[model samples]
Structure formats: C-alpha cells, structure tokens
Target: MWIQEVGEYSKKLLDKGTGEDVVTYRRVQGGEGTKSSQQRIQVNGDGTVTIPKKDADLNISIDNGEHSNYFKNEVRGGNADIVEFDVPKWFDDFLKENTIPQSGYNSNPLNQGGTAPKLVDPTKPGNSFEVPAPWVEWIEEYAKNAQIKK
Candidate 1:
C-alpha cells in the first residue's frame, strides 16, 4: 500500500496589479505534487478574462471532459510538458471568416479538370494492368529529381 502525504501549501500574489499569482504545494515523501496557477486580465465591460500569450511552463487544455483523467495520468507519469496557448478573440473571428464546407482537396486532379486514371487493385493475385504513360513519365521525372534509381 502506498500513501501520499501532502504538506506546505501556499498562495501569494506575485504581481497584484497584473493579477498574477502563484500557488505552490508539495508532497512530503516522494516530492511529487501539483500546482495549478493562472493569471488573467479582467476585460472591461465584457465580463471576460484574457490570459496572457506567453510560453507556459506546463499547459494542457482539452475540449472533451473525458480526457481530463488522461491528462492527469500523463502528469503523474512526467509526460505532460507541452505548453498550450489559449486561442485569442481574433482567432475565433479568423476561423469564422475562413470557414468553408468540407470538400475534396483544392489541388486534386479531379477538381482541377484533369482525368485521373484508375489503377487496378494490386491485392488480387494475377490481376495487373500496364501503368499509364503519363504516370510513368511523372514517376521518371520525380525519380530523376530525387536522384533515385528504379
């Protein structure tokens, strides 16, 4: 049986003007613990807070609530080191402005008014077809550029 003894938890405002604070907690035996601290600027008349855009020490955000446990597991395993940036107001507007219906690739041959040749299935034994001339030429050019021999 393993037991964790937590001790010495403290919270202090590092910068009261900026609403920046630090909360530190430590465990007694294994020296393992968690500290969750956040700083935000109160947006005037908006009832919103703005988190600063800076390199984080350890930041993780998940859209789905179910993934929270998984995040905790990673933190315990010392695998949670990636820092994430909270999307800004302008990013949401940009996403709305650039929104488009999902479709085939913009550079797809079919979309570009080019006929794409259908190749025979290679999984079927004894089923084969001659490679298209244009495709062969393209492969030849690609190999020449890559300096690879067939």
Candidate 2:
C-alpha cells in the first residue's frame, strides 16, 4: 500500500514537468495513541505534501508553462531550469524495484539558484517577464488547506 501511494504521488510530480522534482521528509513519531508514522512530500518550487502525524496531506503543483512552447524553447537555449526531488524511502525503494532512472533525484537547480534566462513575454515585445502559473496554482491549492501550526 505504501509503495503504491508513493508511486502514484511520484507519477503526479513527473507529469507536471520533465525537469520537475520532489522532496520527502519523514517526521519521527511520538506520544501515546498517536500513529508512529508521518511524512511530507514537497514538490520543490511548487507544492508540498504534509502527512500530519495522522492524516496524509497531498499538495500537487502543475506547471502549465511546461506544456508551452516558450518553456521548451528556453530549455533548448540553456535558459530553462530544473526542479529537484529528495527521494523518500518509499520512493527510493520503488525506484530500485522498478529500475527507473534516478538522474533527476536530489537535483534542484532552483534551490541552488542556478542561472537560467528569465522567461520573456513574447506578446509584450521586449518584456522579460514570465508567468508563474505552475507556482501560482500550487500555492492556491496547497496554501489554502495547509495546516499552519503556529
């Protein structure tokens, strides 16, 4: 069951972008009557998943720009950046079990602040602004339901 869940979650992240990635953080369990398990999966540069000490939280971010020609053009010109995913035990095991590629794992260019050409607005003619629809959607969905334990 855990394996299947991890696979599905990982697939969703990959579907978002070729250069996209994910991070999984496991929380140490404690206390009586509390499940001795908790986990979080963050889609670097976009969304996050927090499996509270009890319930699981899923946050998915889809980058519409990835589906756009402009983004691909930037990648071709070496101006495109890649997001990273920190492998979780479940995901790691799944990768090993399926023998899938692990090239993108732990490779987050955005976190490293790698240099990439800023997305330009073609319609604006000389405007060097890029729409962050992917991050926007991620924030809208994840931020709204995120549990803020302040």
Question: Which stretches of candidate 1 lie above 4 Å from their native place?
Answer: 1-47, 50-58, 73-150
lDDT tens digits, residue span 10-106, model 2: 3232223334343221111221233212223223233443322222222221122222233223322333222223333343343323321123423
Task: Write out the backbone clash pairs for model 2.
Answer: 22-85, 22-86
lDDT of all predictions: 0.24, 0.27
TM-score of each: 0.19, 0.20
Candidate that scores best on TM-score? 2
Instruction: Kindly list the per-residue Cα lDDT of model 1 for residues 1-150, writing each as its tens digit.
Output: 000100011122243334434221111111125532332121223222232432222122212222323333433333322221223223222222332212342455442232222212223221111222342232222211011000
Return the lDDT, model 1, position 19.
45
| lDDT at residue 58 of model 2 (Cα atoms) | 23
